[model samples]
Target chain A: MPDTLFKPRMNADIKRRSYYSKFIFNSHFLIFLTIAGGVFLYSLLGLLQTLESSIWLDMIAALLMSMLLLPGYRSLLKPADGIFLLPYETRMDAYFKDAGRYSLMLGISKVITGAVVALLILTVGHDTFVISLFLLLSLLHYIANFHINKRAINTQISRIGMTPVLFIVNILSLMLVLQHPAWLVLSLILLFAMGKYVKRREHRYLDWNAYIEHEEVQLNRYYRNVSMFTNVSHLEKQFKRRKYLDPLLWKPKGASFNKEKMYEFLFYRTFARDHDLPMIILRLIILFGIIMVWMGNIYLSVVIGLFGIYVIVLQMSQIYSAQAYLLWPKVWPVDRTFIQRSYVTYSHKSVFVISLIFGIIFAAIHPALFYIAVVFPVWGYLTNRIFSRTVYKKEQELSD
Target chain B: MVLQIEHLTGGYSKTPVIHDVSLNINKGEIVGLIGLNGAGKSTTIKHILGLLRPHSGEIRVDGITIGENAEDYRRHLAYIPETPVLYEELTLKEHIQMTAMAYGIGEETALERAGDLLKIFRLDTKINMFPTHFSKGMKQKVMLVCAFLARPDLYIIDEPFLGLDPLGIDSLIDLMVEERNGGRSILMSTHILATAEKYCDRFAIIDNGKMVAEGSLDALRDEFNMHGASLDEVYLKITGGGIDNA
Candidate 1:
């Protein structure tokens, strides 16, 4: 019965993968990949041209090998599995075996990709035997690292504890790879024995909560990545208060305000407290500012300024739907139009401030960009007006 | 009547989950909406709260329909959903303050009511704590506090007893009774039939999106031809042994 239960869950995961793949293969994602691929190829070519020694190449290979060793087990276990399937714990060997095999395959593919990249970088004027030995040793390191991660999970080791262990293993693997090949095989066998021992130990307890939590973290990571390109409705939001930014929300103490003013304060606080939105906006502004300063091109600065505003507006618009799930806001005595107006006002103010900062930075960088600075506030106001009438209107309609 | 729903037919989509459901709550009346899951008790309440529009009939609070004036209609009622829906970003104190502001309650009145309700719910100490730090029952208490602080003419509570400790449950009942005696009406949906029987002035039993039986305990007993039947027994019989097909 437990084995049968695995089939539906596996099928659901497959369906999720297929749905995500469809989105990943969409035109926007494909275009992004094409551009990224071009940049990567250009950089790789530049690195190959600057190749100084085999030892430097080996160091890079060691770093890439360590990154590939990071452990991730995608069991797709849900919280309810702990309760609903507790009775069938003894019979869950086949289920776990299948899950382990799936994860192992994924880990192997990643290692293979890393090895291929390493080979491409190391192959120039290098011995075929040395390159083969390097590939073989890296594979062994991957297997050992994967098993160590499994043991860590079974033992409930914190990631902080696992990090030094990973570092030690990576150093050892690099040393062994740089030495005789026989040591690599011996280390691989030792790792395998340790893995078998840990596997046996873990079989004694279900540890359903830990496995479910791991799977949820893994799923959230995938969802978060996918959501950057397109909307993923089922993705759960993770929030942080960002206490260091508390001064940004400074207001006069004991200030009395009406409901509309209170709403404006709430909107500001919501943006400040969100874990990702504020950071994303700040990062974009900084990145664009750096580019403007470096290039000192007024045209590029204006474009970057507009792009910054666009990005800020796009992310800030999420505030409209932020409180949509709560019944209190919807059922409150405040008019719905008031809420809409508050959102619009908040968006306009945020965009205006961001644009003003960008404009000042650009003006400071290149005096010729002073006109761009003056134009940004007006542009921000107009963009926000249009956004509230159009995009915001559509969002309201869709939510309704 | 504080709340009046006349032949309401509404649900998530065009196909109604609740059909022709009609109920009314007079001033100071505590009406229990009793049913198994998916018996449309929540749907009826949703229609009353104006969260869901009725397919055909009209729902009026203080004789004003939601379509006629949404803000006025919402101002007259306070709703506690089956599950707590708190603002993740807001602290407990902020939630109450925001609720008060939204309801147009004066600052002094809001502070007094908030202080009393927080003390009663035993959440005064966690006043500055965020909802993320709260336990399930603590979150429910926060919702209860916010609702009570609103001081609306009608209270729409769904599954209010869930996740509440025995003491918390007793406090909730005490509050409901106090509100009723203050001439505020309540329409509560619950599966805890015994408690509902004790507190409710009338009971409305629904099954399969329609009303199966309704009235006071004596009236329900007389209607079902089971003299002195308890609310739970009456409910089980009406919902066909309460199998919870939903």
Candidate 2:
């Protein structure tokens, strides 16, 4: 064993590992699981059927909860934290191969769960063709997992690449149903074969660097979106500060005396840098805009508000992902007064921003329902302030 | 005394890495902690810094135990970890500011002190740069600046010379001497016995989590019966027997 095997030569590596470990395990994994699990549950619950336009929307949601969420789940759930195990460069192949297999198992599980949910929901209407299609696709996706796992182990194939080519082929198969039957079936089989082939090629080469790079990109992307969701200002500050971002710099007049301003700094920074917020925003814009244009149900607006609540929770969790615990000011002669005050202000500011956006959007949906939106934002802001303040106080007490 | 560790026995958890290790340094003194890997130099430092909970010992910083008032106890000491730990999101300026804020330095004083320290470390141009952009030596410089910002009574530095260029190493030694002259104490760990021998006022040698030997060059030399020999000679005489270099 090298003298430095367990001992990091530098404090930075130890500190970085320490800091990131908290994030990867506690905050990052928790948030990923929460979002993925919540969506899966929501889809399973058949909650969106109230706004039910077509079976296609439900299918899409199920598909999203399966494919996109699984990729995310895979990233967080994989053994990135146990990187020390791969200390021997010679063992990298075997180590990552196991990791790849683990990822594939997770992917297969997600595919199976999704198919079961789809089958249950679709079987109620008794569409034999669609039912058969779902099963066929599920089986193909499951079989494709070994390939996906191999690809991940061998190469830099992204989540973007790991997408079910069979799903697209099935859709194409659907499109070509009337004109060319045999070719459609053949295309679907070929697409599955291609996915399997690419996966094999990836395994054959075992491109460790590429796989690591791919994983890094996925993590960065996730963190970026989460950071954006949590604090838009922080993200902007890190990147290029937009002229529009400057307006938020001014502390709301009366609240200026309060530490909300400090939180605003952290909040804005969190959203701007995290991955969850931007993903949520993109999701909200695409989802809500579509619902408004097509469905236009006032009741669905309530659903949107609830979804916004989920989004807000996700955004808040991203702050936790930054793992402030590892950055304990205990080592420094930090001003207890300032940290105490700033902690409260930070959480409050986050709540206020979330409530404001949800309130304004919900109110804009209908002028008559403006009170619900208004009350919700105000109530949420105050409640979160009180709750988070208590939590911070309690933590401080524990530390003391 | 600047730092005092008495009977410290702690490690990751349950199993102790440092077994009843006791050591101390007075004001204006430079003490070296020398050990092979897994000999628990870092663990000993962690106890002194109060980062670890001693299963059976007491750690005092400038005459106050960490249990008395952790925050206040910390005020007397600054630490340079073996590897630099920086906030990737924060710019170098922000890191300095954060450190300043934590230490309760006024913003103006923090900035002024930060400026001087940055210049001293030859990092004036990189204040606006994020730590993510810093090279290994530059990151180490940032950690050094942060540690020096407080000018505490004691500096508990772990593996200070790693990743430093020869000039950087020289400057660090100069800084250590300068700080000691200013009535601060430094307890540092290193594999570089020659530098440690040249600069340290006293030395403690730990092996297998136990203190094998300690004292000034002459004292160690006398103890090991190697008269007028260097610290290395004494060190080798004490530890070279049946010890795996690997």
By DockQ, the best candidate is 1
Error of 1 at A341 (Å): 3.7
lDDT by residue for model 1 (B94-212), tens: 78778878887766677789899889888888876787678889899998998899999999999999999999999999999999999999999998888999999999988989987
- Lowest lDDT sum, 10 consecutive residues, model 1 chain A, at A250-259
Model 1 TM-score (B-chain only): 0.97
How many angstroms is residue A53 displaced in model 2 relative to the true structure, after the best TM-score fit?
13
Candidate number achieving the greatest lDDT relative to the actual structure: 1
Question: Alpha carbon lDDT of residue A369, candidate 2?
Answer: 68
Per prediction, the TM-score for chain B is 0.97, 0.95
Residue A139, candidate 1: Cα error in Å is 3.0
- For model 1, the local distance difference test gives 0.77
Tens-digit lDDT track of model 2 for B2-54: 77778878897898888988887888999999988888998888777666788
Candidate 1, residue A248: the lDDT equals 77
Q: Tell me the TM-score of model 2.
A: 0.71
In model 2, the runs with Cα more than 4 Å from the true position are A1-170, A178-205, A208-271, A275-307, A314-324, A335-340, A382-400, B6-22, B55-58, B207-214, B240-246
- lDDT score of residue B133 within candidate 1: 73
